[model samples]
Each structure stands twice: as C-alpha cells, then as structure tokens.
Target: MAKRVLVKFSGEALAGEEGYGIDTQILNYIAGEIKSLIDAGIQVGVVVGGGNIVRGVTAAADGIITRTSGDYMGMLATVINGVAIQEALEHIGVETRLQTAIDMQEIGEAFIVRRARRHLEKGRVVVFAGGTGNPYFTTDTAATLRASEIGADMLIKATKVDGVYDKDPKKYPDAIKLDTISYDKALEDHIKVMDDTAIAQAKDNKLPIVVCNMFEKGNLLKIINGDTSLCSVVK
Candidate 1:
C-alpha cells in the first residue's frame, strides 16, 4: 500500500542551479517526481520553508520591526512559495491544493485537518503553507504538527544534504552520515539539523522522519517507495 507522506522541502532546495528564487526547471523536476508518487497511489502533502526568500529572525535583529511582525512576514513568504508550487504542479497536470494557516479565502482554503485529509484521500496533493499561524514556531515544527494531525506515515525532510550527518558536512572534513538513528540520540547529541521542538514533536508522535536531498533527481520517489537504506531515518 502507498503510504501517506508529508514532505517538508526547504527553500534552499528550491534554489536549483541559480541558487535563488523559484527555478522553473527545478520546480518542474519536483512536480514531475511528485506526480509519479501521486500516480503510484501515494498521498502527498508538502510543507515548504521560506528561508530562500526571507527569515523572520534575521529581520527582527535590526530593531526596525518587532519579532512578531517579522515572523508574520516570513509566513507570508511561505504563502508565496506555496502558490508557486501549486502553479507548477497544476501546470504539469497534477491535481494540487494549497491550504494556509493564515486565512486567505481568495488564494486557498484555510487549513483544517479533516478537510486536508479528505483532499488527500480523494487523491489530491495538498500543500501546507503558513507556519503554525504562530510567531515563534518554525516551519519544521509546522511540518511535524501537520504530519501528526494528518496521520502521515512519515515526514520526509528535503534538505540540501543527502542525509543527516554528525556535523555540518560542508564545514567538517570527516562528517559522518547516519543511515539510521534514534530520536533520543539526535537530541542528546545535538544534531542541529532541525529545531528541538520539531524533533520532540515527531518523537512524541513516533512518526518516522527521513532527511534526504531534494535536489537529487528521483530521491523523493525512492523515499516514498520505502527505501529505508537510502536516507537518514530518525526513528
């Protein structure tokens, strides 16, 4: 049976060859990959981050805007990304829906767990936008929360790196990638890959989390296909 997977793609992953903005080539690639998953009967949900465009915390440091206001701005950035992804997917003939935490009736439906589930069951790929509708929470936590609420089988975190490493692989010469690791170990060792809150949420829900490279072609498909040995799995 096809599993219900919540894919959390970071903004950096969408940077593609140019390293900024929505790269049409990469979006099409991702859309094609996701369409394959939908064709194979998988229920797909996406939670995209907005780091490529703006980060609330970074803007809050200038003292010009309050943290809450900055975070809200970041949330809006996610909505922009969501619309881009929705358009890309729809252009490829994939049925897609964008549900936001912030109510914007003109763009997409406000996020309701049950309604989102219904859409998934009906074979529509649902894109979850807007952070938790809260200021402090990161999109990582939003992904974890949504995955738990939607009863997804796993949270597939699409990162720039292929898998989770003991340290920042780019900075360290001997960073080791783990094929499988426990949530306890990730917390105790301070992996720094995701926020502690997000990890804790996933651990509490006992949802399998896989960290993989989104830029690599067919990686997402392999993940949904249950190739556990291919990526870093946090159990």
Candidate 2:
C-alpha cells in the first residue's frame, strides 16, 4: 500500500447526477471513501478540477471570453469545489486543510510545498485548489505538480472510466482496457488518460500514476493496496 498519494477528482464527478453543481450525496460518498483511506493511515491530498462549473479553454474557444479571464474564473471554481470537499471531509470527522495557489486567505491557506507536506505528515488531508494559479494550465497538471512537490508515492486519477482504454469506451464498443502502460506509450499512442503535460511531468519525476473509476465503491482503497486489476498504471 502507498503511504502517501494524491487523488485527482474531476469537477464533473462532484456534480454527480445533477450534471452541474455539487451533489450532497456524491460529496458524502466521496468523503466516506476518503475516510476509509484516512482510517487506514494513508496520507491523502486531493486536486479537484473546475470543468463542471467553467472550462477556460472551452469558454475561450467560444470566443465570448478571453482565455485569461476564463481561466481565472475556472481557478475560482476549483476553490469553491475545494471548500465544499473540505466541508464534506470535516463533516465526517476527517481533518483537512485547504490550500489554494491563488491565495484565498479567507477560505484557505496559501499553497506552500513544505507546509502542505507538514499537513500530510500530521494526518490531515490537504486539498489543492486553483489550477496552478495561472492560465493555460489544466488541473491534471496541477495534480501532478502537487504530487511531485509533496513526494507522494503515486498519483491516482479518479475518472468515470475504469481504466485507460485504446479508444473512447463510451463511443467504441470494442475499446481495449489497458492494465498497464508506459509513459512513452501513453504519449505516443495519444491516450487520453490525462493531459500530455501532466503525463510528461509525472514521467520526468518517475512518479507512477493509476487511473481508475472513483464511482466504484472501495476501488480507491483497492488501488492504494496494490491492486492493479481494476486500474491502469502508467510509469
């Protein structure tokens, strides 16, 4: 089992059945899953995306908003999700610390690598908000960056899919699920397990990444416990 890990949750996952905004039941379910990890002595850090609320790249593509402004809005949306996650974790008696790259002091502390490491060491789950505090960056990159900074053993990307597939499983009925893949192969094949930037960063740091379905109960804990059958590992 990994002693420490960083889990990347997509903003859409937080939306649950509503397809927008946070869902109370979903939040509670996620909190329970996280609580299981905490109870098992795993130090966890979370990086949540803001695509459910606002996607800077998508907005910019529409030509209505500047990319810079849209990205900033997306970053703020991440903070909102972070706060909601913090509340959910705390409501379940899990101690958590919210840190934002953009420095929303009223809601969270400034992102400091050492401070975040300390928080994890103290058995507190640290939630990283804001997408690198900059435009033109995705939360996948942010998660990889935070994982490297905090020396997490591995980065776990929680997605709707069970694992990395050769093609879009939703669209392609014959899609093949990969049990394991190399970073080079992922990049070469153009697999959409994560953004290229994030994959490259993780590769450079020699950090392994596990892609799995978060909606499946106990899957996260299983992955941490060295179960790779249900997920795809990229190293």
Candidate 3:
C-alpha cells in the first residue's frame, strides 16, 4: 500500500444517480472507503471538484456570468462538498479536516502546506477545497498541486469509470482500457483521464496517478494494495 496518497473526488461522483446535489448513501460510502484506507496505515488527502453544483467553465460558456465569477462560485461549491464529506467522516468516527484555498474561517481552515502535512501525519484526513483559489483552473489541477505540495506517493483520481480508456467508453463500443500509460501518451491522445495542465504537472513532478472507479466496492483499497488490474496507472 502507498504510504501516503492524494485522492481527487469529482463532485459528480458524490451526486450519484440523481445527477445533482450530494447523495447521503454515496457520501457515507466514500467516507467508509477513506476510513478503510486510514485504518490500513495509508495517509490520505483529498481534493474535491464542484462540477455537481456548478462547473465554472460550463457555466461561463452559457454566457450568463464571467468565467472568473463562475470559477469562484465553483470553488465555494467545493467547500460545501468538503464540509459535507467531513461531517460524514466524523460521524463515522474518522478524524478529518477541511482546508480551503480561499479562507472561510468560520467553517474551515485556510490552506497551508505545512499545516496540511501536519494534519496528515497526525492521522487526519485533510480535504482540500477551492481549486487553486483561482479562475481558469480545474480541480484536477488543484489535486495535482496539492499532491505535489504534500509530497504524496501517488495521486488517485476517483472517477465514475473503471480506468482510463483510449476513448470515452460510454461513447465508443470498442474503447480499450489502458492498464498503464505514459504522461506524454495520455496528453498526446487527448485522453480525458485528466486535464492537460494536471497531467503536465504530475509528469513534471514525477508523480504517478491511478484513475479508478470510486463506485466499485473495495476498489480504492485494492488500488492502494497495488492491485493494478482495477485501475489505470499513469506515470
């Protein structure tokens, strides 16, 4: 198992079947999964996206709001998700901390690299909300940034799909699932495993990323246990 890792949870995954808003069952399941990792002696940090509430880029494309404002709104949405997850974890008796890039002192602590590392070392799951506290950046980038800052052994992106594919599996009947792929190959092929900026950042930092399906029971634990068959490892 990895000694330390960062997991990126897409907001959409938290929404479950309803397609919007947090689902109690899904939140509890995810919290349970994180607790399992913690119990196994793996230090875990999380960066969550706000796409379920509002995708900044998508909202901006609709032309009602500027991209900057939309992004900030999205960041706030992440904090909401962070808080919800924190509550779920704590309710299940897992010690967790919510840290935001943008200050929201009443609820969460400001994001500090040292403080976050300390929390992880003390066995607290640190949830990073607010995507880089900036516009024009996806949460994927934020996840990579946090993973690099915390010196994580690996970045695990929890998605709805089982693994990275040559094409969208839902759209392509014969899309091949890649067990392993180079950063350059993933970027060159325009694979949607992650945004280009995130892939580039991970590549530059020599950080390996595992893309896996969060909905699959015991998958995260299996991935941490070095079960490569359950996910795609990108180096």
User: How do all models score by TM-score?
Assistant: 0.95, 0.98, 0.98
What lDDT is obtained when candidate 3 is compared to the true structure?
0.94
lDDT of 1 by residue, 1-235 (tens): 3389999988766777766678878778788878988988999999998877878998798989889999998898899889989999999898999999999999999999999999999999999999899999999999999999999999988877888888888999899989998999988886766788899999999988899987778888887777766689899
Sequence-dependent TM-score of model 3: 0.98
Where does candidate 2 have its weakest 10-residue lDDT segment? Answer: 186-195
Candidate 2 versus the native: TM-score?
0.98
Q: Kindly list the per-residue Cα lDDT of model 2 for residues 1-235, writing each as its tens digit.
A: 8999999999999997888899989989999999999999999999999877988888888788999999999999999999999999999999999999997799999999999999999999999999899899999999999999999999999999899988888899999999999999988987786999999999999999999999999999999998999999999
RMSD score of candidate 3 (Å): 0.9
For model 1, give the 10-residue run with minimal summed lDDT.
Answer: 11-20
Off by over 4 Å in 2: none
Q: Is candidate 1 or candidate 3 better by lDDT?
A: 3
- For lDDT, candidate 1 versus 2, the one ahead is 2
Ranking by lDDT: 2, 3, 1
**Candidate 1 collision pairs:** none
Q: Write the per-residue lDDT of candidate 3 for residues 87-190, one digit (tens) a residue.
A: 99999998999999998899999999999999999999999998899999999999999999999999999988989988778999999999999999988986
